[model samples]
Target: MKFQAEACTTSVGGPRWERRLAIERRRAENHARRGRRTFRLSRIFSLKTAVKLFLKLSRLQARGEANARRPIIRRVSFSFPNLPTSFDGFRILHLSDFHFDGEAARAVMIRDMLRGVESDLCVLTGDYLADYFDPLGRVYCNLATVLSGVRAQYGTVGILGNNDHSEFVQRFSDLGVRMLVNDGFELGIKGESIWIAGVDDPNTFECEDVAGAMRGASSGAFKLLLAHSPEVAREAVEADVHLYVCGHTHGGQMCVPVLGPLFLNASCPRRFGSGAWRYKTMQGYTTTGLGTSAIPARFNCPPEAAIIELRRAR
Candidate 1:
């Protein structure tokens, strides 16, 4: 029931050489994806364009755009019977889906929003770049500026999302955030520890390996899984994951009031699409994320950064 530091291997995940291969592999995949009829059709008949036009006509574009910029803090607490006593009240600052463009507004807003916040650990689920083809220089710099304001005792760990390229692993790692692409490790506090397993983008890239990420995690131990999208919820549950954290749906980025999100884009159930939900004995939370995609606006669902506190249930 104890996690050994040495049990975690540095060999797995995206190594330097693996990253190079991933770049080539992903390039090929992107090329193929672009040639698909669905992809071609979507481009020809753009939903993003239609949505933008509708917003502009209704005069809600400004409001939606403002909503996208105005992110809020979400706090939620969970109690676990098997959680280590020393780790009680452990706070995890979860930020996801930056979708950072050339604009500095979102980054500055995030920095200002997290001024006095503190946490034991920080986790980032991906989609860092605003567009798949956008250069990384601006995105990386803006992300660094935002991270500079964060105050996490144990530092940050992140995984890639559908929009991110393979090179982001090394680039972000250089920024001090441990990149966990199809890899995992143990985090300890006061002699007690837990396993954190992370996978690559399962939605677009389809390269996620949950089993590989959970390689060293022992059965019945406290296991936390990080994924770009919640599509892997079933696999996580089967792998005995305790908590699954993700952000891809964006809480239906643009909702229709009472109907909720128009599209989840993830394969998981609607119940697990946003906020917190339970499956069997496992608990999970899907963040609304920090930025908008497609249309770059939010309707009822505003952007968010989460403060998740873990308490020991006695």
Candidate 2:
């Protein structure tokens, strides 16, 4: 009887042990399934977060406000003490890359920016229109009207960029912008003689003759060169230009916060992407430009018009 009881107990104990093991296995599988589900949910949440951030940035840019405020017009001022007395304290309002479309509001915004600028000369670097040809002549005509309204003591001078084709060239000329293509002209500031030279787009559709532009320039006279791309800085320096004004890189168009411009399209080093850069005796000022390109959006790098004041160095 005791042997029979022992056999029964052994059989009952074996079945209970197997049942417990099966239960533990099922619990472990359920736990693993829950972990996988949690991980998937986490990934989904992260992706949603990234999408939300992108959307927020897009909304902010479209609203024309990055930080809950209207886009502030950036005013960059620079003083060059090495300027000659003839053009002492010559203030030049430099504007570039006005990619005007049929947007009336944009024109008004640009006009507002130019409203209170008091300068001796207005120099439009290039990239005046986004249109390939003068497809929208009305837009360019309106732009010229707004540009003509700017008050400058000397006058407004402009050059043709890669974007400005024959049609734009004519329209700009009609607007009273002295379009210089591999040409040099003299301007008198306070009875002091200075040379203003401009070259056509080098990398694009125009002939760039640095030598031709500076042919008649006097060595002693203050030389200001307007070449759209800062890539010509080396040539400008070799030509012994005092100041080189350009606006092609657009400060890399888009830049990361604090880290600044990611890439500069010009041949110059990335450090020369924006603001003022000095190579030997030549000073090159590359404006961030007044418009957008490729992406039509700006972050960290804002559109700007600079006022450069030249003064004789002590």
Candidate 3:
């Protein structure tokens, strides 16, 4: 369903200047991607390129590519003491890192998975596109097709990731996904309510202000934080957020047998890399993601979309 901004109360959390700074930061990152610095500054590091080349030479690229198309529906449950009774059994459809332009089959897989899935809320943690240089028209067209399959009760909301550009905020908003940039909306049920706030890219852009994002919410409300990466876990905890959801690591994208992911690309601890973990009083879940990044492949780590059920702790 199309999410109407005015359907619920919204918090203009951060100041306009903060958003301006974030846009400028994104523009600078974009500028860095245009020249000889492109390979060095972007997600396409020499290591990832080398890994891709190795996979191609060893005939393992095809298997990894196949794995990318086969995403799993992960079911996770969390019980929170502050969670309102009305929100009990609330199912959150958490999708992230679509990288829509990467693989055509992934889109089809997502459409199939979302067919009968029902949720009270849907949150997209970002990395909607695979490459910064990809043509916007085709990329967004593919994205629109993928998003058309989503069915949620409250509606879908998203935040930007490192790979996303500033323009996508409006782009996603146009497509019925409310783009939260250091802002949020309140979901109310019979006078009981919770706040869903999202911050800008904290990993690459580093412009997130957790307290600013929680501006309009009450002190005791169950605050749900949406960030691109787990990098802001500590900040969310400091802001008194009850839950934090994000995705950027892609569950290591390419992992080994027991050693796990070779590179998480996230600043937080390894425990918070790709799944649910607790930080002080706040609980967070980082999805493995639905698509691959840097190199279009997956190893032992399969792609996934999370269906998180929130229960009020007795």
Candidate 4:
């Protein structure tokens, strides 16, 4: 039997081969350069930026985020003993925990929802941006569309939450929303007055000053406190606040049937963490909120913008 012998090219040193090798080398060099550049960036970056980058790159925005576009309006009314008779039936539109973080449809929904809403006052309780993914200072670019035409006779007031950067106060203020940082405002309505105060974020960063916010307001005066987290509820009530409003819990955004709250990052009691509850004489309300956080999808709990009416107790 005769076997055929096969010939193979042993010299890959031809001009064409040389050109191919050169191209391969360039690709390797580029890959190495990119890795080095990323290393340098990691070295100079703070933990915050690193975490944000990781979350943005690796996090999966869950489905049903579009459900976030249609928010329900929660209308709750309660009587306050000290609420002025003339101010009875005064309505407050509470918009909190927006978690805007650049979701266009949700932003547009907020804008449309408020178009037909009329209130004596408006309050924004924080978590303005979902996380660090959104570029700093751009949170309001879309929020302005929602807030511009909101009908509030007194004005809109805002406070920062754990998810917010300190500089956001001025940004919201620039958009005509009165941003209160550990401060108080005495608002007169119908010849009577109520004290509205806001505290800095106390849930994650712990910079709140409730006593400071209560300054200048009388002990017997009807007071409302705006906070980003219900964690501040105890502090506000201790400061002689008559009522408190906050968000951040998202009403257990995702809850198990009877077990409830897949996870609640807040320290407030579970019952008082979501809707209306009272501590001593102080009434507190926490909204499920208008948007989502971490993951855009919410299960069991639907998004909401709340309208709370204040009336005098008989």
Candidate 5:
């Protein structure tokens, strides 16, 4: 028996199926290539963005550190319209928050700052030493030397802060720095009388009785209240105080770039952060302070000693 030969047709359908398969393979390969390209571009963009952000952050940090190291001095002058003729232009050098701790360099810098100013009186607000450590002994000695060099026609008056202990107060007293703790004194200058009063820190220890402190003061005398914290401005105003000088918040210590003070523990309003403020008949001035505390750094808020030239208002 013989088998017959069968004819197979390679027609349009067969080639079309092969072409479709080839097209599908090429499409898949192209898709994969596009996906890899897209992934590579995304990675590059992310890396570039991250690098830019890191550089920006570095610059900002450098700027902040630079500002912290810079010392910015603020000068404020006030005029009392009804000031007595004899006390017309009495200038005062207000320095506060020394926070000294065996750092003779800081003390010398302070002395240099005060040496250039010409004032009738120098008022030291408080915080003579940073803490109750043994190093504070050296700090006190250096501070005493600096205090002895401070020149004022009237005198150098001071008060204590929360960080100060009884021993510190005694040391200050020995240095000819009069300690005014919840007490008032009268300064007679050219027949004109000015009541200088100091109140204890209201936040830390309890020694502030503003009313009682000013009870013995003459009613007609111009009242100048030296307080460590500005929170007592209400009591001072109630006692008819004309001027209030304080330095506790450290002008928020580390002020933010655009946001201002990072943190202010003050009881007063935020607007009174580190400058002169007026409320009713009372004028409150908060210094940026002379030294650092807590964190030994300051940003936009720099250490300062104020020269407040009081002029008679026309």
Candidate 6:
């Protein structure tokens, strides 16, 4: 009787142990499947993200190339009733946002476009290099070559942009581009002087000092301010700047046909993103600029070099 009971217990225990093993094995297999599924989902997500980013970048590049190929010149006329008679009919070639980078071909294209363009003075509002943060030596050389074609009687005067660095101020100066960092330059025509006061980039570096730049400006002198961003136009108005030139906003870089600038990337009104406007008594002009920013391409809004003809209003 004892042997039979022992045999029965062994049989029952053996089946129970096998059943437990089977249950655990199924759970392990299920866990493995879940882990594999999770990994695949994660990989797919990462791949999708990378592809999206690449596609967006490519699109911008395409747009940039297209804009570069078809360079446009905007001939604009501004009548300043208060403008000095000496500066009347004074034509300024306003070129801004020359974030020069990429292939040498781009520089060649710029040279071809500016072949016959003429101006009494050339004013580069800022952003000579496309990305100062990149390996900069090449960018510097590119700038010199690209701007070589730009000609003016009084030469080129520049102000720093948000993307610019402290070192570039001197570098640009060396290239015959007078970079004014909260400084002033006096232009004398037949003993009459016109003050060109420039402030550093007002947005990115926040180094602009309107009062400091205008320190030596004579009372009631023809004072013109060169600013990087039009965001500071209001401040210039308060400071009694007669004319303010800027170019940080790429005229909404990529604009929608009917809706206009989709992203102005500026604090001022969308209208100020490009073209001429007035802030109180101050006349302000913002350039669509010559090159793209953030990305290398543009859409709808083509790259342009602005020719501003200053006329004394009747």
lDDT of 2 at 76: 50
Give the TM-scores of the predictions, in the order they appear.
Answer: 0.89, 0.75, 0.89, 0.78, 0.76, 0.79
What lDDT score belongs to each candidate, Candidate 1 first?
Answer: 0.83, 0.68, 0.83, 0.75, 0.71, 0.73
lDDT of 2: 0.68
Mind giving the per-residue lDDT tens digits that candidate 3 earns over 1-314? Answer: 34774543333334553665566676667777775344444455567777978999999999998888888899999999889999999999999998877446667668778889888888999888886555567656767777777778888888888778777776677777788888876889878999999998888777777888898998798999999999988888889999999999998999988898978998889989888999998898999998877788898888998999999999
- Tens digit of per-residue lDDT, candidate 1, span 1-314: 22122332234345533754676586769767874234456665776677788888999988888889889999999888988788889898999999988888779889989989998888999999887777678988888888888888888888889888777776777777777877888887788888988998888777788888898886667888999998988888888888999998898899887788877888889988899989888899999999888787898898999999998888
> Candidate 4: what lDDT?
0.75
Misplaced by over 4 Å in model 3 are 5-45, 102-105
Instruction: State the TM-score for model 2.
Output: 0.75
How would you encode candidate 2's per-residue C-alpha lDDT over 54-112 as one tens digit per residue?
75766855643342112344545444555667776778888887766556666666677
lDDT of 1: 0.83
TM-score preference between candidates 4 and 5, better one:
4
Which ten residues in a row are the worst by lDDT in model 6? 1-10
- How large is the C-alpha RMSD of every model relative to the true structure? 4.1, 28.0, 3.1, 21.0, 31.3, 24.9
Report residue 52 deviation for candidate 6 (angstroms): 7.4
**Poorest 10 consecutive residues of model 1 by lDDT?**
1-10
Q: Write the per-residue lDDT of candidate 6 for residues 74-115, one digit (tens) a residue.
A: 999888776778888888888888777655777777777887
Misplaced by over 4 Å in model 5 are: 1-72, 132-135
Candidate 4 residue runs with Cα over 4 Å from true position: 1-63
Q: Give the better candidate number (1 or 4) by TM-score.
A: 1
lDDT of 6: 0.73
The TM-score, computed over Cα atoms with residue i paired to residue i, of candidate 4 is 0.78
Residue 184 shift from truth in candidate 6, angstroms: 0.9
